[model samples]
Structures are given as C-alpha cells and as structure tokens.
Target: MQVLRPQTSGNVDRVLDCHGNKVVLISRRRVFSLTAGCATFLAAPYLSLRQSRASDAIELPEVRGGGKIRIGLLWSLTGHLSVIEKPSRDVALYWIDEVNKSGGVGGYQIEPVIMDAKSDLKTYRSAIMTLMRDEHVLATFGGYLSVSRRAVMPLVTENRGVFYYPTCYEGRECWQHIVCTGPLPNQHSLDLIPYMVRNYGPSAYFVGSNYIWARESSRNAIEWLTQAGGQLLGEKYVPLGQDNFDVICKDIKNKRPDWIFSTVVSDSDIFFRKEYARQGLSSDRVPIASLTTSELEVKKLGVSYGEGHILSAPYFQSLGGATNAQFVDRFLGSRFGESGVTHFNMEETYLAFLYFKKSVERVLQENGHVPLTPENVRAFSGGLHLSNEESPEGEVHLDPDNLNSWLKPKIGRFNGLGQIELLWQSSEKVSPKPYLLYPERGVCLSDGLHLPNGTIVKAAS
Candidate 1:
C-alpha cells in the first residue's frame, strides 16, 4: 500500500514508513560474486525462470568434479542488507572452498547456487521456492534477518526444506524445518540486561528497527528489565536503512538513561554508532549495548565510532583459542586481506555451513549415500552432533528436541583496531531453547531460549 520514494542522495535506496522504518530495495545490474576475491558473473544457475529461459542465458565455468552437491544460498549483496550479508557470503565461499579442498562431505564438491535476494521479502520467498522446486538443492544456508527467514518458513516447512538460519533473533518460534545456530533471548537479552542492571544501572532505553526482530527483541528486553528490577527510560524504532540517527540519539541524550540497548540492524547500526559519538556520549556516561552490533559492523564504523560499545553473542573474533586464532588468520587472508575483522553473525553462518556439511557426512555414513532430498537432509540435520572444535566457538552441539545448537555465550567490547575484546564468557555451553522460558541468575530453568542460560524468568511476550 505504500509507495517508496527514490533517495535524493546516497547510493542505497530505501522506502520509509510514515513512522520512519526502512524498506530495502536493490538495483537491476544482475551481476554477483560469491566472494570478494572471486570474479563477478551473472548467476544463471540460480536465476528465475524468466532470466534463465531468455535466449541469451549465461554459461558458467565447468566443474572438474563429478556428483557436485548443490546447496542454495540467499543473501543480499547489492542492497542495504549487503552491509551485513556480504561478509556472510564471503565466509560461506571461503569455508566451502576449504571443505572441498579437504574432500568435501563424502567426496561431493559443495556447490552453493547463490541467489541475491537484495533485501526484498518477496525475492527471498520466491528464491527459496525456486531453490527447492527448480534447483532441487540438498540443503540451504542463508537469510541473515528475521524477516527474510520468516518469509521462507512456510515454504521450507510445507515442502520439507532444511534451512540453517544463523543470526541472533527474537525467540518466539519453534519451526521444525529451521536449525537456528545463533543465540536467543536468554543467551543474549536476559544475560546482557541483568549484567547491565548489576554493573551499569537499572534505567535503560530501547532502540531498534521497526521490524519483527526489533519489535520482539524490545518486548523481551522490557520483560527482562522489569524482572531484573530495571526501569525503562524510552523506546524508539527507526527506519532500517535510515542514514541519520540525530532524532533518536537526541532523545536518548535528553533522557540520560544508564544505558541504551539497540536492535538496529545493517546500515542503521553503523549510522547510530557514529551519531552517538557525535552526540558526545561516553561509555562512562550512557553506554550503548546491543545484540545486533557485531565485529562486522564495528569494523565498518571503526574504533573511533564503535569503540566502548558492548556486544553479546555466541562468538567473537577475539575469543582467542588455538582454533579461533587459526580460523581468524586463515579467514582474514582469504577474504578480508587487509582488514583483520570478523563478527558473531559471520562465524555463526560459517558454523551453520559446517553443520550442514557434517549432516551430509552423517547421512552418507549411515544410509550409504546422501540423497539430495529435503527429508534426508532434515533427518541428517535432526540427528547431527556437531563438534565445537571444528568451529572457532567451543563445544557446540545441536539439540535433537529442538533444531537450535547449544552455544557458548560471550560479551565483548570493541577496541581501536576494529576487533572485539573479550569481556565475559558463560561457564559452559548453553542449551538452544527457541521458545524462551527465561532464566534465573545464570542457570536455565525452562529453556534459556534454545539459547541461552541464566536464571531468566520466561518472557511475557
């Protein structure tokens, strides 16, 4: 019902709701590259029916191997979502390349038939359908935002597709088809907020994008703050792709809450950090805490803009184990090159890809062959016991009862070099409870949200 207006300035285009939330859109050049180090090409193999059927259908380079395993990837590389999605794409390619070099899941080369949804919900919905109905992918790994995942859930469920969604989100669903490899509310909001209430103060402000992830996360934030005996100062939802945070930042400055919690994603996350700096707010004054601001966004904003901020997630580039150090060096060399930075979301997706790879192996080992079918893929994933050592994160195992993984939780502070400095870590791996039942002071009673651990009371939402 709302018509989007073209932007008069800047490269990214966006549609704004009357209340100031962004709707993402992309241009039509139609070229895609799997990784930044690779060559760009028209992704003909993953094209829509119209594009692939046209007389001038593009030809792709031939693979030298037999029985290549096709997996679908849906990410936004050219739209506003690209800010967050590009790194995930690069990591996916690099990780897959490594897997192939090491024999690749029962000797089948992993070929990701990549599709750029370009931040359009319709494109995401149709793309998942296309991958299933047309490409017949064995399994799929992508969808960074909650909205994108929500778009494809029904299709994935109805058609029996195995979708690995790797992002910290509002924990409100328990879809059987999706294996969430990121932290839920108990792992993040409940853990981080109580820490804030004890260390920072009781009063806090809430800021986020006007979407399901933000809305739901903020609602969970309210419940946790109240349970922890903290008071709400204010709450605001800004346009997702909005370039200016002057209005929201000014409100927070006036309120002077002990801390500001944010769920702003993609470009808006970076914008708000810079604006907060410009507003002269210091960590000692009113700290900014976020579930969405990760090493990727911190790298983009730089330490000048991103420093002193706090992030709560399952992994950070600075977690510094022998495994983490090796992964960081190798991944940085292959993709980032000059910028030695990565984030929780990128690592989470990388872990998701590894889970899929492990599942393929499990299916093959048990059934004698890996079938390129959704039922087979789901069964394999449903029974997998993924090792955390293979991942930079420590001791990860997927829950068969729920599709999410038991992951370690950590809080980090960004430094001058665009890296997360580790602050605190959970005592052990936390269970994945997608439907959060909150927790009690560091121990999960009902479910730390397919999460998350701590003695958090179940969320009111």
Candidate 2:
C-alpha cells in the first residue's frame, strides 16, 4: 500500500549548518508540512467544517415540497404600542393557522414570516424592506400605530407590494399598494363626533397624543364640533407614552368643559383615565369621551378607572351577533380561556386577515391559479364585501380608489367593571374621506353624562 505523504520544501543550507551534514532521513509526512503549501486551500475544509458546526447549532425550517406562499406579518411587537401590537401579532398568527387548517389559499400552505417593528419608525421601514426583498413575501398584513404605517407606506408604494394596515387611523392618506382595513376618521371619528354632540352636548375639549393620527383625528373632530353648534374649550397634546397627566388634568379641571373629547392612544389613555380618577373627577362630573380607548385598554385600566368612560369604535367584544359570539368564544377560549376576547385591535386583525383570505380566494377561483401578485390582490379586494354579526357596526364594504373599508362606528360606555356596552351606532355605512370631511364644523361636545332624564347639552356652550 502506497501511503500518501505531505509535501515540504527542502532547506539544504539550514540542515547543513545546523546538523553538520549528518545523514538524516526526512520523512516529509508531518501534519504541519501537509498543511503548509496549500494554506489557503486547507482553509476550504476548515471553513466548511465551521459552517457545518454552525448548521448543526441552528435549526431552520425545511422548505416544503411543492408550491409555497410567503406572507409577512409586520407589527409593533415592542415599545410604546406593544399592548395593542402584541394582540395584533397573536391574531395574525391565528389567521395563518386558520388558513393552513382550511387547505390554504389557492392550494399552497402559507409561510408566515413575522417581523417585529419594536414601535420604531426606522425598524418598521427596515422590516418592510426585508420582508419585500429578502423574504419575498407576496403580501403583508400588520401595523397598529398609524405613525408606523405611514413610515412604511412610501416604501410599499415604491416597491409595488401589498401592505394591509389594520388600525383605525386618520384617513388623509391613501396609496395604491396599501389596503387599510381599519375604520377611517369618517368611518369612526367624523360620525361619532357629530352623534355625540347631537345627543350629548356641544362644549368639547380636544386631547390627544402628539402624533399624526391624533392630530389629524382631533382636527377632524374640531371641524365636526364647530359645524354642529359645539364650542371648543381647549386642546392639549401629550407624548404617546407620557406618564404625567397632572398638568392636563389640572387644565381639564379649570376648563370644566361638559365633555373631554380625546384621541389619546395606547398606554397614554390608561394614564389619562387613572389621572382623571386621581383628580376625583367622575364621568358624571366631567365626562371624558375618547376615540381610541377600547375594551382592551379598559381591561388594563381595571373597573374603577374605566367605568363610566365613553369611547367610539367600530366594534366591541360585547357586540351581540352569532359571528361575534363565535369569534369571542374562539379568541377568549384559546388565548384568555373561555372568555378572552376583548381588544379592538385583535378583532380588527382577525377581520383584516379574513378579508385578505377571502379576496385572494376569489381571485384564485376567478383567474385560475394566477399567483397572488399585488395587482391581483388589489383587483380581488376591489370586489370584496365582508359582513359578520361580530362586527358591531354591521357590514363592511371596500372602496376601490382608496382600498379602505367603509364601516360604521359604534359608541360604547364602560361600566367601570371592564365591560363595554354599546350605546350608539351609525344607521348606515360611513364612506372613507381621506381629506377633512368637516374641517369647518370641527367636533361635537357634550357633558359626557348620560342622564336619566335624557337631557344632554353642549358643555362649553
């Protein structure tokens, strides 16, 4: 058997000088010699060895045989808006699991690539780019905070990809690549403001988080209020995660408006409610009507703080209907145990994903296995109509131009025990008006109190 030998360079001068020309057999078969001349070449095996070790360290999902559909779920999983964003994330996963259980859209199992924005605009921008470029996700459904949505909208439009945003927002922006599943200002705030003023009173104070959604929504409210014979008491803006409401509370006390109309979002709402209670102000003394606080936030506020508070939204957990009941049952049973359904964003997320699935299915059925391109999704979405009993505002219709749903808004009063009961609902669908619908009118104001005598008046007036 011929043994493989290592190649080595012969240095006769060193050997002659050191060994004095002694006869010595050079084996030329050492490990160091074997690796010398081909050091770079030797690196290949070592590099591959390191890579193999790394491969063993990390476990990755195997790409399933046959067709695979990639969908991205980008949401604010951390930072200020995580309370709302986390539920959205969970609901997105729920929809993905549900779709896979039902044989998926167009016969391919969905590969969900979930990314966390961490409530940072830069992270949101980066996440969307990665989802589009690296993951090659066909479509994405996420974003609870309007600021984050606004950050990613330009990128999605430029890339010509589909981004379905599922939070209620100020409706001044519309894009070709974006589908907004949440109620717009017109669909929620515009109608709600007028109704509250008409039924309650016209003296209103506008309070909100210092963001595009709050600023724009508050502006819309001001317009509607002014139009409806309501007087504006004062306006204040707070940072989203702000803890200090002492100044704002003192201001509210001094103003003593019949009602405080607020667009405060996320944990800021909780702080406002707690501060309101701390100031010994009850809904009866000076009612606080908000556009953003929902069943989810109310739960977080607990019974004492949230009770008697009023909020306007398109849906609530207590909404009575077979569809809503089923949704509530499933959601609560799986997540919160037999009674877990609460957050408005959770329901909105469920609706968004279901709507997308319905549209995608329709397109596949009509177009015959045409892969889900953005254009195809848009076309399919144009003809989409979704109605369920769980929807507090009844049926929802999508607008072709804006790709936004026309849904009614419902008003609810928190009964202090974390239970929200519906008080009012739009009799008909409210269309999406991205621009200011009632810029001159502003928002309606009231005492925020529902009196037994059924008498309501504008506080400022």
Q: Name model 1 segments beyond 4 Å from true.
A: 1-66, 335-339, 437-461
lDDT (CA) per prediction: 0.71, 0.67
Candidate 1: residue 100 lDDT (0-100): 72
Write model 1 residue lDDT over 434-460, tens digit each, in one string: 555543223322222233443233221
The deviation in Å at residue 456 for candidate 1 is 26
How would you encode candidate 2's per-residue C-alpha lDDT over 1-461 as one tens digit per residue?
01133233451111221213111112111122111222332223223223223222322112233577777777765566777777777776656655677887667777666676666655666677667765667788888766667656666655567788877888654356677777877777766777767766778878888777778788788888888888998999987677789998998899888788888877778888889899888888777787678777766767777777787888787888788777766766553232244666777777777777777778777877755676567567864678765353358877765577778778888885677888888888777766556333332211222223555322111
